[model samples]
Target chain A: MSAIATPLAREPVLSLRGVNKRFGAVQALTDVHIDVAAGEVVALVGDNGAGKSTLVKVIAGVYQPDSGDIRFSGINVTVGGPGEAQALGIATVFQDLALCDNLDVVANLFLGREDLAGGLLNEVKMEKEAWRLLRTLSAKIPSVRIPIAALSGGQRQTVAIARSLVGDPKVVMLDEPTAALGVAQTAEVLNMIERLREHGLGVILISHNMADVQAVADRIVVLRLGRNAAEFRVEEATTDQLVAAITGASDNVVAARAERRRTDGAEAQLEEGNSDG
Target chain B: MADTEQTHTVADDLADERLIRVQGLSGLVHMTWNRLRSGELGSLPVVVGLVVISILFYAMEPRFLSSRSLVSITQFAAPIGIIALGIVLVLLLGQIDLSVGSVSGLAAAGMAVLVVRHGYSELVGIMAALTVGLLIGAVYAVLHNRLGVPSFVFSLAGLLGFQGLLLYVLGRQGTINLPSGSFLVEFTRFKFVTGLTSYVLVLAVVAVFLATQLWGIRTRTRAGLSAPGQGAVLIKVGLLAVGLLVLTWYVNLDRGWSYLWLFFVFLVVVMDLLLRRTRWGRHVFAVGGNEEAARRSGVKVGRIYFTVFASCSMLAAVGGLLAAGLQTSVSQASGTTDTNLTAIAAAVIGGTSLFGGRGSAYSAMLGIIVLQAIQSGLNMVGVDSSVRFMVTGGVLLLAVAIDSVSRRARSSSGRG
Candidate 1:
C-alpha cells in the first residue's frame, strides 16, 4: 500500500528522468522525474504556472527538454515532434481536444490516420472501428455518424479520448480533460480513464481538480514552481496536504486564515473562563 | 459475432432516443426536416431556386423552356461552369481567387498565340497554357503559404496584372484565332455523344449509382449498423435515372449531348469523388472548418492550401481552353467580360458556402446551369447587360444571406 513499495515493483512503460526545460529567462521545469507504469493512472497535479503543462508539452514533443532521459518500454528515445511521438506509441490528447467540428465523430476519430481500402476512405471500416472503440470505452453517444458540433462537452471529450486510442499507443496523456466538463461529464471522463487503465495503457492525467485526481488516480504527483514538491498515494493524500504542496508552504493564505480563526476562538473562550472563575 | 450482438438490442445509430426513426420515404423526410432545422440545408435551396427561376422565365417567354434553348444553356454553361468548379474548391477553404478570370484569359491568349504565331501543335499550346496556369498557382501558393499573404489581396492584384499580361501576349493584334480544324476546336465546337453514345452514358451512370448504393447498404448491414432502407435507395436511383433520361432526351432534340458539356460534367464528377472520398478532401474541409484544429491534428495545412490554389488555377485554365475552342478565337476581352463574377457567383449560387468547409463540386454544375439559364432567358426577353448584372447581383446577395442565416441557425441549434 505504500507509494514507493508498489511503484518500483512494475517495469514502467513510459519513464522520464532528470527532465529539465527552460524558456530563455524562465526555468519551466527542473529535475522532473515521472514514471507511468502499464495499467496505472498517475495524476500530475499543480497550481497555475507550476511546470505541469511544461512537463506534458515536453513529453508530447511540442517542446523538447534541454536534457532528459525518456524511455518508452525501457528503450531510450527522443521525441522530435508530435508526429514522431505518435509514431513512437505516445498519444497526447491536448486540452483543446483538436477536433474538427464540421466532421463526424468517425471522421474525427480517424482523421489523419484514415483507413483506406482501395486508396479511398473506407467509411464502413472506419465506422466499425469507431463503434468498437466507443464500445470499449462504453461511451454514451447517439451516433458516430453525427457531426461533432452536435455533441455535448462530455461526448466530445469521449470522442477526443477515443481518437487518441485509434493509434494503439503504449502511453496516453490527457491534459486537463475535465477542466471544461460538467459534473456528469467529468464522471464520464474519469470513468474513461479507468477504462484506459483496464485496457493496459499507461496514463498521465494532468489536472487541477483535486477531487477528480483523488477519485481516479493511483498516485498523485504535485509540482510547485518548477520542481516536484511532493508525491502521495491516492489512499493517503488529503486536500490539505495537496493544497499545501501545490502552494509550497503550509502557512500560506488559506492556512493562515484558518490559524487566525482558531486563535481568536481560543482567546474568546479563555476570557469567558476567567470571568466565570 | 452473433454473441456480440446479443448484448445490444439496437444498432449504434438507433440507440439514441433523441432520433425519431422511421422507414422508407417518411424516414428521409424526417431526416431532411431535422437537418434543415439544424442548418444542414445542403443543396435543397439551390435546387428550388433553379426550379423557381425556370418557372418564372417560362412564364415570361414562351420559348424559354424549348429544347433548343435548353441545349444552348447546357452548352454555354460548360466553360464558366468549369471555372466555377475551381471556385467551389477555393470557396470550400473559405478563400477566394479573384484572378480566375484574368488567369483564364491569359491562358487562352497564351495558347492561341503559341498555336497561331509559333506554329506549335494545338496540344503543345494547350500543355504550355496549362503549365502557365500551374506556375501562376504555385506563385500564389508560395506568396500565401510562406509570406502569409491573404489570397484575396494577391488574387486581386493578379486580376489587374494578368489582364495586362494577356494584353501583352496578344501584342498589338488584340486577338488570335485558333486554327479551325484543330483538335481543340473540333472537340469543343462540334462534337457530341449522339444517339447510342448518349443513351449508353445515361444508362451507365444510373447503373453505377445503383451499384454504389447497394454496396453501401450491404456494408452497413454487415457492420450491424442502421442502414438506409432498400425502398429509399430505389427511390433515389429511380429519380436520378429519370432526370438523366429527361435531360438526354431534350439535348438529343437539339444537338445531342455536347462533348464540352460532357467533359465539364466528367470533371465535376471526378472532383466530387476527390472531395468526398479522399484524405486530401477531408483535410481540406478540416482546414476550412478550423485551421488551428487541423494543424494541431497533424494535417499539413500549408500543403493543403498549396494544392487547393494550384488545382483552382489549373481548372480555370481548362475552362479558358474550352472557351477558346468554343469561340474559335481568343481576344484581349477573353476572360474579361463577366467571367470572374459569373464563375464565383455560380459557386455561391449553387450552395457552396463563402464561409468554407461546406460545399461540393456538383454545386458548380448546378450553379452554372442556373446562371446560364437566367442569362439565356433574360436574353430572350430582351434585357440589357446592365439589367442582367443587377439580377445576378441580387441573386448572389440572396444566396449569401441564406448561408449566413443558416449558419446562425446551425450554431444556435448546436450543429455549427
Candidate 2:
C-alpha cells in the first residue's frame, strides 16, 4: 500500500506545477506543486496565510496564477473565471457557501442552471433532481423546499455540497467543511466526504483540525511559508510528525519547541494589551 | 482494530445531527406561525387602522353596509386597485414606480384620441393604448437597467416627462368624451352572472388558487423537495381561504361583483404568475435579493431591471384605460399628484415588504380596498378631503413602523 502511494503511480485529474501567486510585493504562494487524483481524498493543511487558500482559489479559477501550469485530466488548461471552472467540472464550495438564504434548498441548488420546460421553469424536474442529489448524499434534512435560513449548520453544509455535485464536477474542493460545526455535525460532514470518494470523485478537503483530517483524508499534504513542506500517507503519519512538518521543526524538535514557547509568551502579551484598552 | 467502533460512532453522530436539524426547522416554522397569527404580517397596524376606519364609517351611516354604498366603494376602488397592483410588484423588488400616474394619464389620452379623434375602432384604440404603455415601460426599464440609475429617480423623471407628453397628445382638446355606446364602455360594463354569480365566481377563483398552492406543496413533498411540513401548508391554505371568503362576502353584499374589480384581479394574478413562475420572474427576484449575487449567478441583472420597469409601465397603462372607461372621458387633470402617492401607499400597506423578495400582487387589492374604503366612507360622512390625506399619511407611517418592528422580531427569532 505504501509503495503504491507515490505521485508517479496514478494519473492526476488536476495538477498544479510550481504555481506561484503574488499579490503586489507579498508572495502568497511559491513553487507549489500539488495533484488531486480520481477517487482520492487529499487533505491540504497549513496555518493561516500559508498559501493553502491561494492554491485552492487558483484551482477554483478565482485568480490566475502569476506563473505555472494547471493541468486538467492531463490537458493544460487556463481557467478564466468561476463559470469557466464550473464548465470544466471543477467546483469549489467556499466557506461562505454563496447560498441565498431566502431561497429554499431546491431553488438554491438549481439557481443559475434551472431546468426549463415550455418556456417556463420546470419546478417538478428541478425538485426531482434536487431530491436525488440530497438522497445520494444521504442528507437527512426533512424537506428540500424549506428556506436555508431554517436549516441547521450541518444541513446547510450538505446543501452546499449537493450544489457542487449538481454540475457533476471532476473535482470538489471544500474550504473548512467543519470549521464552525459541533462534534456530531463534523462527523456528518466527514461521512459525506467518504460518500463522495465512494462515488469516484476527487476531493480536496482543507481544514485546520487534525482529528478531522485523520478521519477522512487518504493523503496529507502540508504547506509552510507558501511552499510544499511535506507530504505523507495518513496511515504512516502521526499527529506530532505532521505538526513538526507544518511548523518547520521536524529536525531538532526540542529547540523548535523552546522557540515556539517564546513566541507564544510575546503573542499573549500583545493580545492582553489590545484587550485591556 | 477500531473500524467497527468508528462506524458505530459515525452512525450515532449522524443520527444526533439529524435530530438537531429537525428540531431547528420545526422551531423556525413555529416562530413564523406565531408571528403571522399575532398580526405581524408586515402591515398589521395598517390593517387595524382599516378596521377602525370601517367601524367609524358604519357608525356614521347605517347605509355604509347597504348594497348601493358598497357598490360605490368598489367602483371607485377599481382603477386605483389596478394601479396598486403594479406598485406592489415594484415594491416587492424593493423599488418604486412613480410614473404610474403619468403612464395612466397617457394611456387614457391615447385611447381617447385613437377612438374619438382618429375615428378608429374602440378595440383598436384599447390595443394601441396598451401597446404604447408597454413600450414606455420597456423604455424606462432599459434606461434604469442600462444606466444603473436608481429606479426612483428615473421613474420620477418619467412621471413628469410622460405627463407632459400626455398633455401634448391631448393638445387643444384638453378633454375628450368617450362614446357611451362604444366597446370600451360595454367591456367595462359587461357583468357575467349577477350578485350570487359574482360571489360564486370570486369564491371559485380563490379556491383554485388555494388548491394549486396545496397541490404544489404536496407534489414537492412527494418528490423529496424541501417543503414546509404538511401542517404548515394546511395552516397557510386555511388562512388564505378564510381571508378570501371574508373579502368576497363584503364585496358581494353590495353589487354582486364589479366586473372592473374582477378584471383588475385577473391582471394582478397574471402578473404574479409572471413573477413567481417564469424565468423572467425568478430573475427579478434574484436581482432584488442581491444584485451582486444574482449577477454572479449568471443572471443578466441589467435586463431584468429593464423588464421590471417596462412591466410596471404596462400595468399603469391598463389602469389608465380602466379609469377612462369608468369616467367616459380623458381629462388633463385625470392623474393627480395624489394618484401616484396613493398607488404606492396602497402597495406598501398591502403587506408588500419594502425590502424586496417578499410580496405578492394580492397585496394591491388589499391595500387599495383599505384606502378606497376610507376615502368613500369619509365622503359619505361629509369629512373634509384634506383630513383624508392626514389619515392616509398616518396609516402609512403606522404600517412602516409595524414592518420595521416585525422585521426586527423575525431577525431576532432567527426566522426572517
Candidate 3:
C-alpha cells in the first residue's frame, strides 16, 4: 500500500516546467507548467487554439517541447515519443482515440502488448482481461469479439479508456472525452473518470464542458494563449471565475463584475446578521 | 441518422453478424441481411459470387464440372493463388506490390539459366531462384522503408527494372524448356497425393476443426462469456468435412489430387493461424488498420513494412516457379502477362479489402478459384481473349461495387 502513492494526497506523479514548443512561424506553447498529482483529477480548460491540445501533445510525447524539463515521480525524464511516454507510465487518449475500427475490442485492447502463449496470441486470456477492465469501468460493451465498427461513440470512448489501462499506466490523460456524448453517456464517462481516480491513478482531463470539469475535477487549471493563466481548487473556483480565466486576460471585465457582485452580497448578508443580533 | 438507431447498444449490432452468437439458421440469415443493410459484407459477396459463377459455367459446359477439369483448375489456381496470398498480406497493410510478376519472372529465368545453361543441379538452381526472390523483397523494403518512398512507386519501378533483369538472364534465347527428367519439371507436372492420402488429410482437417471449435466453446462457456453455440460450430464443421471429402473424391477420380493443391491449402491454413492467433499477425492488421494508432501502441512500423514487402516478393518468386513448371517452359512471358494485376485481382475478388485491415488468408484461396473458374469456363466456351479480358474487368468492377455499397450501408446503418 505504501508503494502505491495515492494521486490525491501524494507527491505529483508528473510535473512540467518552462515547457516551450515552437512550430516554424508560430509558437504553439510557451513556458507551460503543470502538475498532475497521483489520485487527483486535474481538469485542463481552455478556448479553441489556446494551446490546450499542444500542451497535452507535448506531455504525451507526440511533440517534443523546444525547451523544457519533464519530471515523472520527482525524477527528470525525457519522453522522446509516445512509446517512451508509455514506458514512463503516461497514457494518452487523444481526441481521435486512435482506435482500429476494423478490430474487435479484445484485439484492440491488447494490440501491441499482447500476452502470448507458445508464440500465439493467448485469446482466452486477452478476452478475460478485456472484460475485467471494462467491468471495472462499468463500460457497456456487449461483447469483446465484435469489431469497433459495431460500437457507439460512447462505447468506443470507454473501450479506448479501458485500453489505456492494459499496461497499468499511472497517469491517464483524456482529451475532450465528453465533447460529443449525450447526457447519460457523459455521466457514464464522468463516473469512469472517478473510478480511475479511485484506483490511485492521476487523471488529466481536457474538456470544454465546464459542468463536466466542475463535476469530476479536484483542481482546475486554465490555459490562455499558450500559457498557464490560473490554477484553482475546484471547491473555491466559481463558474464565472473559471470562464474568465479561460477566455482572456487575468483582469477580464466579466470576472471582475462577478467578483463585485459576490462581495456586495457578502456585505449585505453581514449587515442583516448584525440587525438580527 | 435517427437517434433511436444511433443509440443502439453494440449487443444489438451483433445481430448484424459481425460476430456470430445465437438464433441458429434463421439467426444466421437475419445476421447476414442485417450486415448487408449496414454494408459490413465480410466475405459473403465473394462466397456467393463463386457459387453462382460455378453453377453458371457448369450449365454452359458440362465439362466445366468434370473431375479432370476441377483438378486442372486447382492446379492452375495454385501458383496464382500462392501469389495472391502474398498480395492479400500486402493489401491488408493497404500497400500494393506491382513488381510481383517481374520478380517471379526473373526467378524462373534465373532458375532456367542456372539449371539448363550453366549445368547447375535442380536444388542449386531452385535455391538461387528463391534467393533472388528474397533479395528483390529486401531491396524493395529498403527503398520503401528506409528511403521513405511509397511502396506503389518502389514496386512500379521494380516492375520495369526486374523485367530487364529477366530479359538479360534469357539473352539470345527468348525461351528454354525445363529438362523432362529434372526435379522442377517432374515435381510440378507429375506430383499428386494418392487417393488414400487425400482421405487421411480430409479426416485430419475435420478432426482438428471440430476439436478446436469444441475447445473454444468449452473455454468461453466456462469463462461465462457469450460463446457461439456448439450446435452451430458442429454444423459448420460437419459441412466443411463433407465439402473436403467431396472435393477429394472428385480430384481423386482424375489421377488423384496434386500435392501442389494440397501444398497451397497447407499454406492457407498455416497463414490463417498466423494472422488470427499470432502476435505478428495482430501487428500486421493493426499497422494496416491505422498506422499511427499501431505505432503509438509500440508496434515497430518500419520493420513490419520491411518484412511484409520482403515476404510478398518472396511469395512472388514462388509463384514464378509455379508458372514456369505449369507451362513446362521459362520464357520472357513467364510471369509478365497479367500476372501482376491478376494476383491482386484474385485477392480482391476473394473478399480481401483493397483499402486494407479486413481480410483473411482464405481470401486468396477463394479468390483464385473464382478467377480460375472464369478463365477455365471462358476458354472451354471459346471466348476470345480480348472479350475474356473485358468480362474479367467487368466482374472485378462488380465486386468493387458491392464492397463500396456494402460499406456505405454499414456506416449509414450506424455501424461505424
Predicted structure with the largest lDDT when compared to the true one: 1
Q: In candidate 2, how many Å is residue B1 off?
A: 22
TM-score ranking from best to worst? 1, 3, 2
Model 3 TM-score, all chains together? 0.89
Model 2 regions more than 4 Å off: A1-5, A17-33, A44-58, A61-70, A74-81, A116-132, A138-143, A178-191, A206-216, A220-277, B1-50, B189-255
> Chain A in model 1: its TM-score?
0.91
- Ordering by lDDT: 1, 3, 2
Task: Tell me the tens digit of each residue's lDDT in model 2 across B123-176.
Answer: 888888889878887877777766767888988898899899889999997999
lDDT tens per residue, model 2, A92-172: 888877777666777778878888877778887887777668767887776666667668889889999999998999899
Off by over 4 Å in 3: A1-9, A18-32, A48-50, A63-69, A248-277, B1-21
Q: How accurate is candidate 3 locally (lDDT)?
A: 0.85
- Which of the predicted structures, 1 or 2, would earn the higher lDDT when compared with the native? 1
* lDDT at residue B326 of model 2 (Cα atoms): 81
Residues A198-265 of candidate 1 have per-residue lDDT tens digits of 99999999998989999999888888888888888888887878888888788798788878999999
Indicate the residue-level lDDT of B347 in model 3: 89
Q: lDDT per residue, candidate 3, B330-364, as tens digits?
A: 98887885988889888888888888898899989
lDDT of each: 0.90, 0.79, 0.85
Error of 3 at B324 (Å): 0.7
